[model samples]
Target chain A: MTTAGSPLVGSSGRGRVGRRRARNRERLVSAAAELMAEAGVEGVTVSAITERADLGAGTFYNYFQSRDGIVDAVVAGAVETLGQRLDALTQGMADAAEIYSSSLRHLMRTAVTDPLWGRLVVRLGIAHDQLIATLGPRARRDLLIGVDSGRFQVPDVDIATAITFGALLSAIHAHLGSDQASDPSGVFAESLLRMVGIPAEEATEITQRPLPPLPSLEEARVILGGDAEG
Target chain B: MTTAGSPLVGSSGRGRVGRRRARNRERLVSAAAELMAEAGVEGVTVSAITERADLGAGTFYNYFQSRDGIVDAVVAGAVETLGQRLDALTQGMADAAEIYSSSLRHLMRTAVTDPLWGRLVVRLGIAHDQLIATLGPRARRDLLIGVDSGRFQVPDVDIATAITFGALLSAIHAHLGSDQASDPSGVFAESLLRMVGIPAEEATEITQRPLPPLPSLEEARVILGGDAEG
Candidate 1:
């Protein structure tokens, strides 16, 4: 009989070891993220991550091809998480204020909780050509849906996506880097919503409370077509 | 008597020598910008800049304190130019769309024609904390005036400033880096205008024509507040 977790396990005693290997990879990524937050990107190294995760140097190599490979994995994981959260936040929102507020709050909470991820995004957005190129298309598609439904208004969906993402990342970077008065997340979200033209009174109310309901998936699809489906 | 050009012409026989020093400084900065664009930040060095500018090794030191200093000066000059242009674009505009269109067009032109400066800003925005700190306040004040005047309908001036600046810079970086498109400036400006809540049709029209006239100094003070006489 075949089993779901049998590929690595079927060969001798390798099955049990494969589960451990997967766990170890998760541990290493988590450890690397913690270190990056405390000491910035320069602080992460294979030796340090392995030590933090209580794994051997050999074990680290088994999971990742190189230090950069580990970083790439971590970054990819963070981006995926961010994308999922953003999708959830705007999924049903019909009102522009509600949509903007939910997105701002979601982004702020993510950035505050995982500042290293925020910093990594900002750094990559500016310095790494390949990564930004990959992320740009999906982001543009989302913005276009927002624009088409009147939940957002922009002259060009592509450019607005680039700017909004850039600004959001930069704000998080600044907030994390500073000791300024006020809640960083609140400040970051509030500012971004206003810049994109959500009314001040509406922005204040949304930021303070839970987001209102949005269009159903079908309704959104009717308005935004294939782009909204994504 | 000391005159405006006095610094350009040093006392005694040093006047001719001073001109030579100024010329060398200009050449070094220009060379550094070129090298940075061609090779990325890591590839630039004093030797490389000097060689590219056709100056001797000894000539480089006469002006810059170090390679970092050259980078600082080059960044400062570019930012100063950007600031001046923005100021000029906003000098007399009454409507938000006009201001947005004018400022964005100038910015787009700068990004396309002088891509090196755009890259420098992105790098500095990511790596240099102090530079961002200094520019943040001035940017906030400018944004606030627009908000108060109803030229912009943002909820939070501070957040709006961050988003506006961040979006512009990010879009420019993407445009310069991409090989898939042509003339991204119009699209970029239109995106920004739309984000600020301007109607799409109006944004497109303004972006295609000359920007609205900038406010005179007197009018600017009235709108911005503070010393009307100053």
Candidate 2:
């Protein structure tokens, strides 16, 4: 296991060292997220992260260029996680109300459970122009596909998508910020469906049930187009 | 007429002096808004506002206690003006869709024409939750009356009103923030109507035309009950 003159080699050497490095990086990221959640993004610092991770200052630098880099990483990770969750939740919903209600619930639950991440996402999504530009198109495309297929009654797909999403996020922000007693997600979803012209009775029925399955990939392709399919 | 030793104790004297003070305060607010529009709120300063108003530092303090006070005044003034405009625009709307569309369009036009005020409203609105709490309920009650009278199909009037209003504001923010090619007001109004489950085609038609007159105050009370009417 020990070699003095020879260079460290193969599985026992480079592989083990690489694994250690990856673990260290993972630890740093986790520590950063935890710190941010507890103390807010503004309160987190390099020294605090290092202290939380039980790593030295030099080790922290080895993984991240700066605190901003860590924040970027955290945001990216959170976005990826949210995208995956949404995909899973919306995999096969035929009814527009069902899809909207389910997605709204999922999003609201995520925001409530992980409020710091939610706030960060909303702040980055709305307040930061560049981030919105980068993410808006993809989000719009997903929403339009849902609307175009009669799953939703939205006339102006793009505008409806933006407004609905923004309202949901804002409602979440308000709910989390206040001590008001109500299921914000339920209220948000119910209200949004109502605004889109879904009948009151129908909105209640859809929101009360579990969301239906999304279309198969083939059906999704037909609706979303070949480019979106890929 | 010029008063010598004793001030003229007449209506004209007090009215003239009051008008002068109001004019000076108006000029100061206009100057502050201009500076904020050019530079962001963070960049605006008392000295810059005074300079823009062509007033001395002492005069600036005479009207505003500090930069925060001036900002608050500006925000309050803008909200009041917008609220009045909304009241006028939606005064005669019997149909909820028509009311929502007209009100949304009016708000969007105001936001686009005076982006600085829009930014300030959004910032202050979010930062100070009390602002919306004070304004939102009354506007919501008016819309709810239409719902109760069978003009709209909202199940939960309060939640629907919140989502509709919230969506309208968000849509305007998105349109103004992006390079998207569409009339922000038209698109926002259309989207808002669609969200409530109104068929897109019908939404388009309703939004394009003027709305009918709302019920009288007594009639609204009979329909929505005293709690909602109040």
Candidate 3:
């Protein structure tokens, strides 16, 4: 307890102690993500995580209380920033259909371009508790927007949310499994739009629309409350 | 190393040794099913299975090569009979859409009525390798039927199959999580039918059509190659 001088509770954001704490925490999360990507959610252990992070044994306990705690952090670190990015991208979009389509397309595009992201998503799969916790509300929120706008004929938001989630993960699984050339973002979202009662032509048009570029992960870290980038 | 007089491979189907072998295998499968339903796929260990079956430890290896071998047996034992029953029910049905709808409705109804089945399906989820192995091809076959009949507007059969699998498991998870009164089978199938390009009104009507009684599990066991009912 003599660490009253520790940077964990430093008054200055730029202080040495504050910087060290953030760096250590980031290292732990990155190591956790790497391990999860390689071996899946169930395969990870705290000792493995600390070892991979190059931290001393028991160092993980200072950052995360348990394996589940770090898992939540890993998922939150991935999904929350993406959620924020999507929100910013669609900040002023009036059309709910476009908003929904844009978010899905971007998600698929990210998975396509980022092998690590794709592996993490495919490994976690659809029934992952942390993934669902992080992504479910965002999906439901988007569905409700489409419903409220008179643009969708959804029978039930909850069921639609479930279907959307399942579709995204399963589509990702199939997309990654295949060597065929096709835009998963367009095809996957178009199918979903139609399911929610969007007309065929419109669904196709919306999903195929050009997507805005996603912010770099380093920038997203800042947006997610991490310290400034190098 | 079997006892000299034991009939592990007796020629006569009606012989005492043949009967004992079938009985023992059936007991092991039933015990495995109980453990899986009570816990989950990951929770079932060889020792736990043997303990549950009340058989000597080595008897498990006599029946199943390993835990995975038995897990496959458990999923195949559950899914294959259901697949066979659906085939029989839809054999003469010309309407591809109706055939697809009927199969989904029966699945959901089984989950609703059979809590054990529901728990197992929800626990296994869509990422389950064995569940997908057993159900994936069947799902693709039905989607192909609808596509060939010009009754379904499927963009990609593979993606559609993935969605169907995902939606079914996630919906089941939601259904079991909630205490709602609405018909899950009807709503879930209707939504999927629309996703595959069925008209909303038609999809609703098809999903709401009177569902025929599913063959009982005992009957299913017989259809799946277990012995006749007592």
Write model 3 residue lDDT over A40-128, tens digit each, in one string. Answer: 87789999999998999889998888999887777766765576667667656898888888888887776776656666766776667
TM-score, candidate 1, chain B alone = 0.74
Instruction: Order the candidate numbers by DockQ, best to worst.
Output: 3, 1, 2
Tell me the tens digit of each residue's lDDT in model 1 across B1-230: 01011122223455776767777777777788777656555568999989988998878888887998887666555554354446655755676566656776766666666676666666555435544654565466655666777766655565556666676677777777677357777777665565465556766777778544434333444555563321
Candidates' chain B TM-scores in the order shown: 0.74, 0.70, 0.84
Among these predicted structures, which one has the highest lDDT? 3
Model 1 residue runs over 4 Å out of place are A1-60, A85-101, A127-135, A147-152, A177-230, B1-16, B38-43, B46-60, B92-101, B130-135, B179-182, B194-208, B212-230
Give one digit per residue, the lDDT tens place, for model 3 in B75-171: 7667655666676677667988888898888888777777667777666666677788767888899999999989898877888898888888778
What fraction of the true interface does each of the listed models get right, in terms of native contacts kept?
0.54, 0.42, 0.64
Q: Give TM-scores for every candidate, taking all chains together and pairing residue i with residue i.
A: 0.71, 0.70, 0.86
Model 3 chain B is weakest, by summed lDDT over 10 consecutive residues, at B1-10
Score candidate 1 by lDDT: 0.61
Model 2: per-residue Cα lDDT over A9-113, one tens digit each: 113445766878767777777777667656545568999989988998889888889998877666555554344445555655565566567777766766766
